[model samples]
Target: MTAPEPYAGVTTHTPVRHHILSVLVENKAGVLARIAGLFARRGFNIYSLAVAPAEGHARFSRVTIVVDAESAPLEQIVGQLNKLVNVVDIKDLAPRDALERELLLATLPVDDGNRAAVLEVVANAAASIVDVNATSLSVVLAGTPHACDLLERALEGFSDVELQRTGRVALPRLTQTESL
Candidate 1:
């Protein structure tokens, strides 16, 4: 009989589709690289990483990672990640208890022809323009995640996007100390 795959248990044991990785670390250069390298060296993939400062000496980074790995690898990664010199805390945020997630977006191609529709569409989506340039516009939006998704797709219809990105910030419905 043929052997089963190594990571097949990922589907059987756990069913978490997406994860928010909250990590606390000391503020220093090369720390990000070390953390990133750990993921890459172990065949772990990080979908998105957002690192910023926390109060006091250490820093906090909320990593929006798509968790799609076997239980063993997941545990190993977590264990090793904790061993890093500057790492203070590592936790995986769950989706069910998750309450609100804000997505800030910046879009471009803001010439005379597309500005009207862009504003109208995003306004309906509850997004407001924060910055406007001769050729590009930046918008700040706070609402349901679907609102952000819809706004992005609508902007795509205009033409090839000059630049676009999102800030994925999440908070659970009930505040928790940490997650495993």
Candidate 2:
């Protein structure tokens, strides 16, 4: 008797692409490591990953993984993930079918000469200045990934700007007639 191969029946002919997998798993210590190790052992690249408690529930955590599908077939990724004993559910969210957001926090050196300009840029990006000091400004923006990208690019015009971003987290978009 032998264990079955997880990807045994998975097949795909389409060109590889990016995939967003929302995984629900038991909130145990090694669950994340196991999932990451699985991808690493298979040589699959993870584009982005975000994990948090699911719906304020202490029993489970939600992991949003943006996988580089170019590295492996989506079916194979999902199949391997399903083999994890801690994983409770998985959702492959199509871009248009999902509402995704990322949080960006940036700190930029500012002074009397560029203070107005910096504030203007921040306002234009719809970002708020969360903190201000004599020499620097800390700004925050919680928006769509594209919006965050645009803001990040715009910030590159300044010097000594530091940025940190929370990987994207997404949920399926709800239709107008649907109720949650």
Off by over 4 Å in 1: 1-16, 56-73, 99-103, 110-113, 133-136, 142-146, 175-180
Residue by residue across 1-180, what tens digits does model 1's lDDT show? 211122322222123455556677777788888888888787775655666666444455444443544433667767888889878777666655555355656666666676777777767778888877788887767765556656655565666554344535455567654645
For model 2, the superposed segments whose C-alpha errors exceed 4 Å read: 1-16, 176-180
Tell me how many residue pairs clash in candidate 2: 0
Model 2: C-alpha RMSD to truth? 12.9
Q: lDDT (CA) for every model shown?
A: 0.62, 0.85
Candidate with the greatest TM-score versus the true structure: 2
